[model samples]
Target: MAELARIQPSLWFDSDAREAMEYYVSVFPNSHIGSITEYPADSDEKHLSGMAGKILNGQFTLNGVDFVCIDGGPYFTFTEAISFVVLAKDQAELDDYWAKLSHVPEAEQCGWCKDRFGLSWQIIPENMGDLTRTPEQLQVVLGQKKIVIAELEAAGAGI
Candidate 1:
């Protein structure tokens, strides 16, 4: 568990920084976009492309975590190694999230899904940690990869 909030999680984007921010704000509660600064045509780098103030710097609070989104272009990309999970307290919460977040059908699964922007997220039960740390039951299944949640819990429980 985190003691105090200070550092912000950074997200690099190839484009659509503003659009992504707006969609994100709508997805999670108590979240908003801060400031957005774009590049200026005056500079050699600016003439290439990008909004003059599209959102050079902005802040988004999603499910309590402060995440910063950036449009760094081909310079960087997101991978499954990093993901944001929402600990839903009930079936309703989980179902609602699964329905809304999985708007992109290509990204749906057993409680795990991804956003329209290819950002992966897991919508799970709030007390799921208790099940995973059991050290008795075993289950797992990664993303579209080798393993994922079912295996993780079983492993943690030492099944």
Candidate 2:
């Protein structure tokens, strides 16, 4: 068995854990679906009655980070309070991630976007701090959905 990550972020899905896992692996490089444990068809527990064949625990890797997800019914959901950060090395990388992940237009703000799976992601440049050194640059960033590094640079240069 492969060694697991010391701390993996687990996602709770209503009934699309498998689909979400597959979608995520497709979005990021160096990603793949791992072990998947399904709920028993004959489960007697009331909470798991209709969960036959549903994912109990689905492990996956995305961009070298380990994560787990489950088809845990509609008792819980994803919130913007907890978001994953994708620090891109450059504008092209950032644009690619934003293009692929930004599905909920209403949820986008300040380089943060919500994916189709309802998960929030902050896709920003790795040197965001440096780019937004000035208040003007910071304001420019806050006004855009996607992080345009060149715009920030222009703002910082008083262009």
Candidate 3:
């Protein structure tokens, strides 16, 4: 809990919370896993014991945020309202991520997409995000639909 706030944000997803959490561990740098709870016998095997009720809590830290995944059901699913942004620092990084992340257009928004588990993410260059914080820079980000790494660099250098 003490270190959770240092980096990243925790997100909750119902069906694939567990699998997604583990996958994230492999995808990011300086990342490790944390505690998890299993479903009790009383519940259906299809439903991991603790997976029912008001909130199914699974605490996973990715890039160091106490990313709490909850099986809260379909009442809430991830949307553009909240998205995980991945900062790719270079063209190789961007292309690799774009290819892998945009495999499904149903879950893509320029450089943002949801994985098989319905977890939303933004795969953008790291420097792009840093530069896009200003008024003019922010426009560069919004001007395009998808994240073009070249454009990002151009935007960063104000070219």
Candidate 4:
């Protein structure tokens, strides 16, 4: 028997669950699509909703973290309050994610940006949590879109 993840984040989409899942898998390596269920055309909810044969629910993994996406109609949308934080191992990794993921320039601040799918993401350096010990170091990163590791280190040392 296969073990299941205890908790997984389910993303609600209007009608693009499959597309989003595929896109995510393509972006992150070592990820693949899991189970997928589609709405039946003859179901009672089909005619009124017009979502027949669309993805009812689907699962995928990003960097080993499981996630689910549902074609749940447009009653709700993604918010910035909930975001995925990508821990970049180096400046190259940080730059790659920032360029590939961020789509809304106006929404970017303090290493946070909204992707084309409206999902919020924080592209942060892997050592950031350790570097921001002092209030001064924290302040240095408050207004920057992409974190500069050298600057953060200097700030932490009061240089």
Top TM-score hit: 2
Model 1 stretches with alpha carbons more than 4 Å out: 1-5, 46-53, 103-110, 130-159
**lDDT values of the candidates?**
0.66, 0.94, 0.64, 0.87
Q: Over 4 Å off in model 4, which ranges?
A: 1-5, 42-48
The sequence of per-residue lDDT tens digits that candidate 4 reaches over residues 1-159 is 899859999999888889888888988888999889998675566443678777888989998999988888888899999999999998889898899889999989888999888999999999888878888888888867788777788888853
Q: Which ten residues in a row have the lowest lDDT in candidate 2?
A: 40-49
lDDT of 1 by residue, 1-159 (tens): 878857888887777788888888887888887767665543456534654555566677776778887776767776667778888877677777776676556556545677777778888777665645543422343332212344555467543
My TM-score estimates for the predictions, one after another, are 0.71, 0.93, 0.66, 0.88
Q: Flag the better candidate by TM-score, 2 or 3.
A: 2
Q: Name the 10 consecutive residues with the lowest summed lDDT in model 4.
A: 40-49
Ranking of candidates on TM-score, top first: 2, 4, 1, 3
Q: Candidate 4, clashing residue pairs?
A: none
Q: Which is better, 3 or 4, measured by lDDT?
A: 4
lDDT of 3: 0.64
Candidate 4 yields a Cα-based lDDT of: 0.87
Per-residue accuracy of model 3 over 1-159 as CA lDDT, tens digit each: 566535536666666666776777777666666666654445666445555433355676666556766555456676677777877877688767666555457656557776666667788777664656556666666665457766656656743
For residues 30-56, write the lDDT of model 2, one tens digit per residue: 999989999988578889899999999
Name the regions of candidate 2 deviating beyond 4 angstroms: 1-5
Candidate 4 matches the true fold with a TM-score of 0.88
